[model samples]
Target: MAAVSLVSVSTVKPLGDRVFIKVNAAEEKTAGGLYLPDNAQEKPQVGEVVAVGDGKYKDDGNRVAMDVKVGDKVLYSKYAGTDIKLGTDEYILLSEKDILAVVS
Candidate 1:
């Protein structure tokens, strides 16, 4: 399968319960529909689901269920993830908890 590289980091085999996401670029327009100039536009906290790791841990030694899978568009908290670099590209690896919701 073809995969996009983020942060120039080679394919990261995430540990259990972790996920990889590639942030989507922010829109230039404001919430009020006012289009902000490039200099005034703020960054967006969005990303595309890239890869998923194994399920979460269970007290019984079983894996807990996972809600999101690859290719899911999700909203995350600002500064909620850890950043890594890959060949000049950037990507984030965050716990599933950090993901607020999966965008419809």
Candidate 2:
């Protein structure tokens, strides 16, 4: 498997059922010729999974496997997750339940 490099810190491992997503920037222009202002841009719901946590533990100590993995491109709920920044890059930390679908 290939590796993804996040912050200069070298490694980022999400905790149980959480995922680290590298957010895709919101569009700058509409389908028409109009350009949008900074504050008017929508938050993008699409992102690439850079890291994923181990599956959550079950009541009997069994692990509930995750559906998403690192490198998967996914669509998430528009309002989910905590937004964070590393240097100039923006990212989101979300739970598996917040991910809507994986992009083919």
Candidate 3:
């Protein structure tokens, strides 16, 4: 799921097959122009990849390639990542498996 993070983009580097994502905020206003309260908002499922790990190592010592890269917008599974707050911003750290698709 997407989360809002203001953390410095250069501060953290993901490890293994993990990726750091800067989540997009849920809509505050509906298409009809009705404003929704915070509690009524649904969590967003899309985010921008801030950082990615060097691919995970295989048993044979070969590195698996990462499909997504920095700045790629992607779709991820809801509730699949670890929630983290660095400074005032929030970020998600998730395995590549948690990412379902890359947004074009």
Candidate 4:
């Protein structure tokens, strides 16, 4: 009998103009050197782009080129994207339109 091997999903690839971002860690302390509780921490809006999907298709059957690529530091809308937790890392999957700007 032949054994079948199972593969684990270690990487994520966005599809259809979607982007995958690795969220940055939230602030742990305030400027006054006071540690804030988990509930007090705000959701991070900054993240690094890990993967991107092929650009959206136009009505003329032409594919638009994606503006952002891998490893681009970007800022997204506060409530944008779907939060995803893979293993010990946190990620967000959203459309390119949700991305506000690329940080230098």
Clashes per candidate (backbone, < 3 Å): 7, 0, 1, 0
The TM-score, computed over Cα atoms with residue i paired to residue i, of candidate 1 is 0.73
Clashing pairs in 2: none
lDDT of 2 by residue, 18-86 (tens): 998999988999999799999999999999999899989999999999999888999999898888777
Model 3 alpha-carbon miss at residue 91, Å? 1.8
Q: Candidate 4's C-alpha lDDT?
A: 0.86
Candidate 4: list runs displaced more than 4 Å: 1-10
How many clashes (backbone atoms < 3 Å, residues ≥3 apart in a chain or on different chains) does model 4 have? 0
Ranking of predictions according to lDDT: 2, 3, 4, 1
Best by lDDT: 2
The residue-by-residue lDDT of candidate 3 on 1-104, one tens digit each, is 23436546697889999999978878999999999999999878899999999989999999999999999999999988887766556678899999999999
Give per-residue CA lDDT, model 1, range 33-91, as digits (tens).
Answer: 98888778555678888888887888989998778998899998887778754544456
Give the lDDT of residue 11 in candidate 4.
54
Off by over 4 Å in 3: 1-7
- Taking all chains together, the TM-score of candidate 3 against the true structure is 0.86
Ordering by TM-score: 4, 2, 3, 1
Per-model RMSD to reference:
5.1, 5.2, 3.3, 6.3
Clashing pairs in 4: none
- Model 3 residue 41 CA deviation (Å) reads 0.5
